[model samples]
Target chain A: MNTIEVKELRRIYKTNIGVIRRKVKEIVAVDGITFDVNRGELFGLLGPNGAGKTTMIKMLTTLLIPTGGTAKILGYDVVDQANEIRSRIGFIFGGERGLYWRLSGIDNLRYFASLYHVDPEVTMKRIPQLLELVGLSDRGEEKVEGYSRGMKQRLHIARTLLHDPEILFLDEPTMGLDPVGGREIRQVIRDLQSEKKTILLTTHYMFEADALCERVAVIDQGRIVALDTPEALKQVVSDLSVIEIEVFGVPEEILNQIRNLPFVDTVSVEDLDQKQALHVHSAKGSEAIPPLLSALEGVRVGKVTVREPTLEDAYVRLVGGKV
Target chain B: MKPGMMKAYVHVIKLTFIFTLKQSMTDAFILFGIFVQPLLIAIMALFILGDQGDGLVIFIVVGSGLTGLWDSVLFQSGNSITRERWTGTLEALVGMPTPLAVIVFGKNLAFVTQSLSSMIVAYAFASIIFGYPLSIEAPTLFIISVVMTVLSLVCLGLVLATLFVLNPDVQRWQNGLEFPVFILAGFLFPIAILPQWTTPLSYILAPYWAAVALHMSSGGKPDILEISVPWAMMALLGVLYLFLAFWLFRKMLFKARVDATLSGQ
Candidate 1:
């Protein structure tokens, strides 16, 4: 059975104001929707702003109740079995409201440790492992208030994993991190997934999603528009393939000649000082590169490379618009 | 309780108690002197009002103490939540799986314990130095304190906590509320001595009746039977507030389904 199963869930909030200045109105936040995540699978919910990804995660996590329909986590109902579900899963918010700055890192962990009811003996051992995993062993005794934003985020993941929960709900886990930190966090996620824990990760960064999630659900306008493996989703938008070509000091004639290649769908050039940033798209990366190169052969080419379709390009195509 | 359930609730209760105690110092200190300001006025009443001044100390104690409890729950719970929300910490806590009820209990319990302890200290100080014909009958103080805690402040905390969930802007409400609760709740002087216009406003709420009952029990006025009517109203309102708090929490949870922080799209 799927670790999480949701069926036609809905959440409607009332915003009342009218003749009485309090007449009720409904704001349907999560319209009817359905999906299931398998055990040990790192599922992803991809969405643009306000596409109901967070709403769905909150509902499944038992922080919110659905107005219509139902969801179950580890075979426990999110509504009727809320307490049970809360125990079975852990959630990490990419929110500023992450930790108790007043307390040290291990103190924060200990507090949550007590809440999880891990035996004191077991928790003692687990705390060190968690601190080690997050590379915070040295800082474990320091108050989180002094920690930088990235350091605090790592602590948040530790808290989410504290209960040794089988399923993890990570909402924009690598948000606001620098490239190195993001990579570090991505590696941590891979490690968690390797332990066979199910993670339903949400992120707007396509590369972040593509790198971590094996299967992804693309949500837009409060509904799931597309759900597939990252490669599968890319394949959906891979039809109009876009490739970037780098060239130096190419004249307009050669640029025009490259654009006129048989299979080269569209070509654009940019003059960056003495260099040109060339953009090309075709049905296949290999099919378009040779002809484009041949056209620019005599143009004092310094460096030439064929680019593959990035998930960013796929995302733009997925939304059918620009970022 | 199961081991896990026991752990969740124990953490809730223990954490709540500490939080309330720490928060109470800042809140009650501002008001403790306010709670006693009337007692000093009552000593002045010995010269101003003569024989009638005999029970004035109890009057101020019971009245201000009653209103103090009101102030503690309303101001602390509402204002703290609002302050934290603006500071951007409320969303972080609320995003967790732990119920909102847990957050309310932990924070308010801390404030309440601090208020109770500080109020006791303020009363002891006044009884020693100012010496306003004090009497601390154990059974009476015990019964009234219990009533004040359960039927008035804690119940009110439920409502205030719910308000925190939605609107954290409580300064206006707290400012407008304190004196009215003092005047109407009959905390300082008798609601009866207040002008007829003010009596209607003061006795209209549960805190007013509760203050009066506490005043009577604390040796300020008539017997317990005379205070029974307001005591009954206080108890009823307490239950009602608790029910309303639960309902409010349910709606907040439903409304806050999308953890605002996770707008990944």
Candidate 2:
């Protein structure tokens, strides 16, 4: 059964410009997107900045009303049955700012516990258990201002669980964390999954989605371009092989020439200090490499390697190389 | 509602109050508003109107305290919701099962209660440091008036918080709103001294009645019937402010959701 259902959700922001003569510009942030998250499923939304990933999460979480279409969390309408939905769901927007810096970790939890209307007796028992779960049992007395970003994030997770919500909406929960911190959060998410909790996470990190999510949706320009298992989504580029050619001074026109080849799919350049690396994708595999080299002519070349496409390559193709 | 839900709401209010009071304690701006500014105003009032009579000391103390109360309401209570937005917690609060107005009401309760300290501080500074003997003519009535003042001011604060969230231009004039309330509320003098036209303006403000009731009980003992007028006005206006706030809160939340500017600067 679907725990969260969204159908053609849309959000448009009207911005007024200028002082005297004003002009209204309507920016469609989320444009009629439809998706569903099943019970106990780990769903991920992958997109670049301003691709409506956060907007979609906000709509499902009832933080923002949809401009069109409809969404239901645990079978309650997001617009009309918000209070019923809010009670059963918890969400965390990625950042350090959501916590009260002046309060201790325990105090913060205690305070939010009251906001969620947990029995004070239950809070007395649950606070410690949550602290232990987040590995902050020893540091619960410290003010959030002194806690590291990772600690604050863990506390945020603890905050969300105070109500023991059935559905969790995390918007880039690991956005700014270090690799270790991010891994710890991913572990927390994994633990939640083990407990059979439903989670919808949005992130710009492709591999993180591949590692954590059961199914991932790749959104671009306010719409979902592809939705499938990470491995299945990678099949968009599975037929093509990626050739990385390290060249010292290859011009843009030469890269364009490789794009014009019969088998070449897309060509993108990555700056590598003194040298620029050209990533050329083609369906002909290694057979297209010789022509790619011939197009390079007198451009000083470095090591060239060819490999199968990963999710990142698939993401690149779906978003049309916007990454 | 059921008794269980009512108890839960009370518990939520209790927790929110304690936490908000603790948080405000660490803020230097809140400290100045509820403490330093009031004491400074009290000292000026003492020196300026000092020598008039012994009764005037108590008058100055109550008057200066009202300034602190109004300042707290204007700045601290007014920005309660905006402060949550700035800290990025507005979304979390809005998404909670409990209504946003309930949480804000708890916050305003803390602000107004803590601001009451301005009166105590001013009273202490007068009776202890300045060696002026100050005592309320009717302590019971004064205490009751103080309670009414807090409730009414909290309701008024609710309106301000939601109004400021709904209209950013009104918040831009927040600094300008301060002394006008002080003048019109007659925190330092009688509103009767002002033009007759401004009396209706003063009558509409809860702070004005708060001043009337506070001054009468503290400085001179008035009969129950005489003092009940300000109390009734405060009660009536408190209900009006609450109704206005209820409407404003709905409009503000809807607007914020539509605009998706809950956490925006």
The clash count of every prediction, one per candidate, is: 13, 0
**Candidate that scores best on DockQ:** 2
Native-referenced Cα lDDT, model 2: 0.92
How far off is residue B250 in model 1, in Å? 3.8
How do the residues B1-265 of candidate 1 rate in per-residue lDDT, one tens digit apiece?
A: 4547656766756755664453344454545533554445434533454345545655554544555566666677655555555545454455445555666766766665555544454456546666666774445644764555544566677677666655547544656876777677766666677778877666447667666566556664455566567667777777787788888877655555533322212
- By lDDT, who's the top model here? 2
State the C-alpha lDDT per candidate.
0.68, 0.92
Q: Which stretches of candidate 2 lie over 4 Å from their true place?
A: A245-262, A268-278, A287-303
lDDT of 2 by residue, B156-259 (tens): 99999999999999999999999999999999999889999998999999999999999999999999999999999999999999999999999999989988
In order, the TM-score of chain B in each prediction is 0.74, 0.98
Measured by TM-score, the strongest candidate is 2
lDDT of 1 by residue, A1-323 (tens): 78999898887766658765667777776788888999999998887766777777878877666789989998999877777777678888775455667677887787676556556678889999998998899999988879977788889889888779989999888888888878888888999999999999988888888989888887766777778888887776566666666676778787677667777655656567867777666777766666766787776555556556766556655554323
Clashing pairs in 2: none
